[model samples]
Target: MDSGLENIVAAETVLSDVDGQAGRLIIRGWPVETLAADKPYAAVLGLLWDGFFPELGDDAEIQAQLGRARAAAFALVGTFPMESGVVEALRTGWSLLNDSEAFDDAIAFPAAAAVFTAAAVRHGQGLPLIAPDPALSQAQDLLRMMRGTPASDAEARALDAYLATVSDHGLNASTFAARVIASTRAGLGSAVLGGISALKGPLHGGAPGPVLDMVDDIGTPDAAERWIDAALARGERLMGFGHRVYRVRDPRADALKAAVSKLPGTAGRIAFAEHIETVVLQRLARKYPNRRLETNVEFYTAVLLEALDIPREAFTAIFATGRVLGWIAHASEQIGEKRIVRPKSVYRGPVPEYA
Candidate 1:
């Protein structure tokens, strides 16, 4: 059996598809690039929920529901103590949600839960939790919460673009984990919690934060080559270079880089990151020659998020904020299809012998 079921097709889905060789991602018939620029998070949510929640209300109603739900979640944050990491706080907040009476079959139910959970976790760390503004979009609200105030139009727009860009990819590790949990007929909250848990691992959503760490350690473009070289020699996997899906550069990398361009103060970081990218690529090409270790999504993710003033500890939580849309959509799709996702594994050890 392949560890972690690599290369396994566990479910049939009409969700997003990850074309690694082509460096493309298609979400519900739209290219990720189409949504990554200026599309509000709420709009993308509607798109992701397509064919799953046909009865979902209009944008205004959905936004109102999200705001109400977020406010409700804010009140509960005080009940769960904040000691573990942000991911743990998110998970615990979601677990507490299981007791909510308003948790019926409403479309806004899960969305609200995720927003509040993320905000509460951040708030518990003594950061102010900005209440959701019906006047703002989902991405804007997230940024507002993280920054303890309203985001500038450019900042909000950049974050919206980033969130839309990463909202979904065809059945990546976290999505797979969500689907596995959903296969048991668990609630959407449980599935999303599973997804968040999977993403918290360093190999997945946690990589972006360390990319910044790597950049900070290198301190200069001239030092990047030596730093990466030493790390490679020690057998440490470069944090932001490779991907499980894409053999080449991640398409999302370019998309996010472009999105952050419109924001002020991002230019310098972008240039520095580009220099690091060049150094890393040049060193890798000279050293390995055959291995296709190109920049993946995490490389630019660190730069952009850091420029936005997002704390490194909060990186994975923010990732979850974007990915929850995809998780909810997939969960709804799985439930509608009436399929229990079970896969058979071939046993390799000695079988029982007949006497």
Candidate 2:
């Protein structure tokens, strides 16, 4: 009866592995650092969906197909009202993909799902959803659709880097949720939707947005230590500072910080964030000598996404957009094995009642 299933190995997988103690993530035989340095989002997708998706031409062909699918999804966003929350809008838009005759393939699933989710959320805000251009990369196309204009080369590359870095992580909550859905023989879209639902939880995807809120409240670097100290004194958890898994700083933090550095006007914000990080670390070390409250991925995720012009509320949805690739890959991996993901539970409640 391990509460929360700690240390449980519910399923076997060949997907990415999260090594918290080592502060490392290995994805499909490649270190995350190597992938971030050399590959684009399309290439990472290729690696993740290797065994599941049949040889889908090359990176160029996959990019083109995804662009076309995105445009198709954008056209359908108007059918669903945008007044609903982003998750609901995304879920509703995903149902529309079922109308397509060729929605079963793994390759097509992620491409269309990314498009539909982004467009649906944007459309719900009464914003115009841009059509995807086959000429552009997936990251650029996503930026174009979200911003209603083509992203600058730096912005495009920054986003590409972010998507590539975040495309997958070893069996995290969302990926596990995705695997559970896929084990039921549900389609890729269903699995991805399940992943998104899990990511929407505050403990997961909700942290990044609150990082921005925390920064805004602090107003200046000089005030960071005091603000964080007061919050801690009040029994409040500081957003973006600690991680559940990593004892040291999150490696993804460095990757995202580098990516955001390429965006215009981001240097100053990065510097300010660095100051906050320094203050928080110093304060935490002094206040709780035994605690390891290091900077986590959410710290820089907030800065990078904010620099990319993504609205605070849209952070999780955008996270879902990138992580959808990993979700699909895990789902396919689970389906290939054809096993149910039901884990055993230790019942501690009352015995059977008399009927």
Candidate 3:
């Protein structure tokens, strides 16, 4: 049995594909680079959900539907308590959603995901939840809600790039969890809930905050090599340097690095991160020449999200805002399948005869 299911093919999807060998990612038919650079979050969502739904419309129409859904989700902001964690608070907002089996739920889940995340960020700062503006795009509305004002064009575009860049990948852990729930004939609520739970694991979506922490620890480009060397000597896993998949550089890294670079006031941080990245790669090469532990998505994901004024604790929630679209589409894709996704296990424990 493959313990980690490495190189295992589980489910077939038309949503996205990850070519780890060549370091490429295709979402629907569009390359991730173009999606990040040229498309809005709504356009990518439209692409992913095009044929999966009965009446998925043009990009502008989809944006309108999601706007209504976001407005609907914003109505429940003050109804829920601020939980110990931001994700929990976000989940609480989603739990209030009505009609999980309805077609509107698909649109509502992502709408709610973004709205709740922005609300959670504001609540954490001892601020009130700002109501959604139906006129603004999804990215703009989210930033507006979080900041309690109009988001600049640059801020909205950067978030759009980030959300679209991470909209989907080839059957990741959270996606697999979502599909498993969907396969069990569970409704969309259960599927999305399961996805969020899997994404909360630090090994999966919790590294970005610490990537910034690493940058803060190093303080300057000159200190990067020494800091990384000392950390490596202590056997601490470098947070952003490697990935479980991606034998080459993760394609998402460059996509997000470009997005982060385009934002205003990030030039110095980008330069510093570039220096640290170079030092870390050189050291990692000298240490483990056989392994391709290059920069992964989290390396620049931290840079992008940090520059967005998003707090570390809210990163996973914000990631969920984008990925919930994938969850909904995948669940819709599995509607006709009857398989229960039961994998046989090999028991190695002492199986003595019970006379």
List the global CA lDDT of all models.
0.75, 0.76, 0.86
Of 1 and 2, the candidate ahead on lDDT is 2
Instruction: Give per-residue CA lDDT, model 1, range 1-355, as digits (tens).
Output: 6676657776777778888888888887778777888477777777787666656576676666666666666677667756777777777777766521122343444455446545655665766555666556666676676677778888877877778888898788888887777767788777877888888887778888888888899897778778878987887877788788888888888888888787887777888889888888887778789888888888888888887888888888778888888887777777766778777778789989899
Summarize candidate 3's per-residue lDDT along 221-289 as a digit string, tens digits. Answer: 888888999999998888898877788999999999999888999999999999999999998999998
Q: Candidate 2 clashing pairs?
A: 82-124
TM of each candidate vs. truth: 0.91, 0.93, 0.97
- Which candidate's lDDT is highest? 3
Q: Which stretches of candidate 2 lie over 4 Å from their true place?
A: 99-104, 117-125, 352-355
RMSD of 2: 2.3
Clashes of each: 0, 1, 0
RMSD of candidate 1 to the true fold? 2.6
Give the runs in model 3 whose Cα sits over 4 Å from its true position: 352-355
lDDT of 1 at 26: 83
lDDT of 1 at 42: 72
Residue lDDT tens for model 2, 1-355 = 6666648777666767778877887778887767766677677777777777666657777777776766666677678765767666766666666521122345555566556656765766777666677677877777777777778888877777677677888678888898898888877777877888888888888998889999999998878878988987897877888777788877888888888887889888999999988888887888789988898888988998888787776777777767888888888888878788888777789898898
Let me know the TM-score candidate 1 reaches against the reference structure.
0.91
